[model samples]
Every structure is written in C-alpha cells, then in structure tokens.
Target: MYSAFKIGKKFLHYYFTAANGKGHGVHSPFVFDLITKVLNDTTNHPAYTEVEEQRRLLLQNETVLTVEDFGAGSTKGLTKQRVVKQIAATSLKPKKYAQLLFRLVNYFQPKQILELGTSLGITTAYLAKANTNAVVTTMEGSAAIAAVAQEQFDALQLKNVNADTGNFDETLPELISKPESAFDFVFIDGNHRKEPTLRYFEQLLAKAINDTVFVFDDIHWSAEMEEAWEELKQHPQVTLTIDLFFIGLVFLRKEQKEREHFVIRF
Candidate 1:
C-alpha cells in the first residue's frame, strides 16, 4: 500500500492527466456512454440510502474480532484483534466509489456477479442492490468478518447474495468449477499483492464472456499493484481498460476494433 504522501502525489498527477469526467473528448462510443451515463449518474436511488443507513450502524458498533490477513497486510502494523467500527471506517469502500460501482452494475445488469472481498458487506450490499435479479457470490477470508457481513445481508434481505467464508485460494476454485458459475461481472478486492491478483484474473478468465467486465480495487495501492494493472491492460483477451485512480476496470468485449486504455477522472 502507498503511504499518505505517495497516494496524495499520485492522486494529484492522476487528476491532471486523466480525461475529462464529462465525456467531453472521449472518442470511444462505449466509454463515452459510460462516462456520460453510468459514471456521472447522480440519481439518489432508495437502495443507496438503505445501504448507507446500514453503514451508519456499522460505524457505531464497537465489537472486536480476530482478523486473518490473507492479502497485503494493512499499512498499520498487523494486529490480531480489530474493532468493528475501525474496520468499517478503514476497510470499507468510500461512498463515492461504492456508488460508482452501484451505477455500473445498475447500467450493465450483469446476470452473474462475483466479489472477492466482503468487508462488512457494505459494498456487497451496493452491488447486490443494483440488480435484484442478478446472482451475487462474495468470498471472505475471515470467518468472523464473514459472519458480520452475512448478518448485514440478512438484515437487508438481499436474497441474491451468497457470502462464502474461507480462503479465496480454496473457495474460489471450487466455486469456479461449478457448471453454473460463469460470471459476467467480477470485483477483485481481497488480494492486493501482484501475483495473487494476476493469478485470480487468469483463473477467472475461463469463466468470462466477451462482454464480461472486471473491476480491480486499489490499483495504485503500491508499485506492484500498478505493475499488475499494467500487465492486465496488455493481456491479449482484454479489449479495453479504464483507470479511475482508485480502481481499474477491464473489459473483454470482442467488438472492439483495437485494444485501448483510458485514464478518466472520477
């Protein structure tokens, strides 16, 4: 993960170099539509309020649980026990990015969605709520954290979600091997290291279609993660990629005439 100073510097560079957020000069019709429609959508859907309300509750909870680190450990030194409120504050995705994800899912309406991390299930709730008909399968490494996420899902009555608790290496393969596990939308957030992130992408490729969309969180978290993002952009199967500083979105659309990459301000 990047230090505060490094992250600030990168964000400033990204803000200046990235394309306009209003789709002003974008040439690709698909990307233009995304910027104009999905990325910029400001509709205050009821689901947003409901999920945020849950987040408010989580912020107040002070229960502590033993967290198992499977990916790049937090910049804050590793500790066995962490408070629920702290996890909700430090781990959960911010409202802006989480809402952007909701807009993407709401627009694309992918039938099968897979999420690698389920921290407090706030982001998972946003994804699941975006499309009530889609099947969402989210994996969590910590049993304690998974239990909390499960409670959130149950409280929200998000019936389409399946919170699978276990190591992603063991659980992911089993889920992908199933005959009905072809995912059209995937969010990789659990692992932050380069090798594991790349490995997960490779494994998930087998289940992806031409229209499949994959979103990677914390793309610029570290030098290795940036390297992983770059390598993924150059992949033969990836037709397009969009860098939004915090997250990177990959598309495998066969209709693209040429592979392209875009850095768009968000």
Candidate 2:
C-alpha cells in the first residue's frame, strides 16, 4: 500500500481534477442523475442512525481477538492479536462513504447483494437495513472477527445478512456454484492486491447480468489496485464507471449505449 504522504498527494490531484459533485458539466444523463440523486442525496434516513449507533458501540468495545491475515494487510500493522476497538477504528469504512452505500442499495434495491468483506458487520448492517427484502451475503476471513460481526447482526436483528467465514479465494468460487449464483450487486472489499482483486472480478463476472452493479473499494490504495481499476474500466463489458477517490463504482448497464468514465468529486 502507498504511504500516507503518497496517498495524500494522489487525493489532492483527484480532488482538483474530478468533476463537480453537483452534476455540473456532466453530459451523460444516467451519470448526471446519479450525481444529483444517489451520490448527493442528503436525506437523513432512519437507517443511518441505527448503523451509526452500532459503530459507536464497536468503537467502545475493547475485546481482543486473534485475526488471520487474508489479503493486503492492515496499515495499522500485521499483528495477530488486536482489540475490537482497534479493528473498528482502522478497518470499518467511515460513516460518510458507508451512508453512501446505504443510499445506493436503498435506491437500486438489488435483490441479491454480495459483500466481499465483512469487518465487524457495520457496513453489512447498513446494506441489510437499506433493503430488508434483499439478502446480503457477507464474507469474512477471520473466524474470531466473524463471530463478533455475527453477534452484532443478531443483536441488531438484521436477519437478511448471511455471514460466511473463510478466505475469499477459496470460498468465492464455491459460492458462485450455488443456486444463488447470480448477483444483482457485488461489493468487492476483501482483498486489495491486483491479482486477487482481478481474480475475484473474473469469478464474479460469470454470474453478473447486464444490470449488475459492481463496486470496488480502495481503488487508489496502491499501484496494483489502481492498475486493477484501470483494467476494469477498459473491459468490454463495462459500459460506465465513476471514480469517487475513496471507492470506484462500475455499471454494466446495456442501456448506457456508449462506454464512458467519469472522475466525479464526492
């Protein structure tokens, strides 16, 4: 992964060059609507309050667990033993971006959602609450952390979440072979390396439909991740893509007509 200084410099360049978040000067009607509606929507839905409260509880919990390294390891260090609070602070996505995910699920209402990573179920909770009807299948690498996440999900009564524990490289293929093979929305957040990321994308691609939405996390975290993002953008099946600095959203919608890519400010 890139150092803080390097990441900061990249963010500065993106902030200056990305299109305005207010949908200004963007020509694509679908993208313009996403910018004005889902990306910029400020409505304080009740689900935000619920998930945030769970985040606060996680931040305060100090229970320690031995975590297994499955992908690009944490910047906080590769220590095996870590407290719940520490993982919550470093691993969980910020409320802003997380709320944006909730909005996306709420707006699109994808029937089947696949989450590549489930840290402590904070983001999973958001995805589950966004649409109770939608089933959220979340995968976690660490058994200890997965237990904590499952406990939180049970406590919050998020019945739609189906937590699976294992390394994604081993489990992802087996998952796609099941009856619930096709996914409407897939959030790739587990591994950050180029090879694993690309492998996951290819495996998931078999089950993806034209309307399927794929979101990749930490696209700019490292050189390899950025390379993976660029390759994904250039793929023939990818019709549209939006770069939000922190996360990258991909659209395979056939109705888009022409392939377009936008670096939009968020």
Highest lDDT against the true fold, candidate: 1
Every model's TM-score: 0.97, 0.97
Q: How high is the lDDT of residue 124 in model 1? A: 97
Whole-model lDDT per candidate: 0.93, 0.91
C-alpha lDDT (0 to 100) for residue 141 of candidate 2 = 86
Q: What is the Cα-based TM-score of model 1? A: 0.97
lDDT of 1 at 69: 66
Candidate 2 residue-wise lDDT, 13-120, digit = tens:
999999998999999988888888899899999988888988999999999898886878554325499899999999999999999899999888999999999999
List clash counts for every candidate, in order.
0, 0
* Alpha-carbon deviation at 180 in model 1, angstroms: 1.3
Off by over 4 Å in 2: 74-79
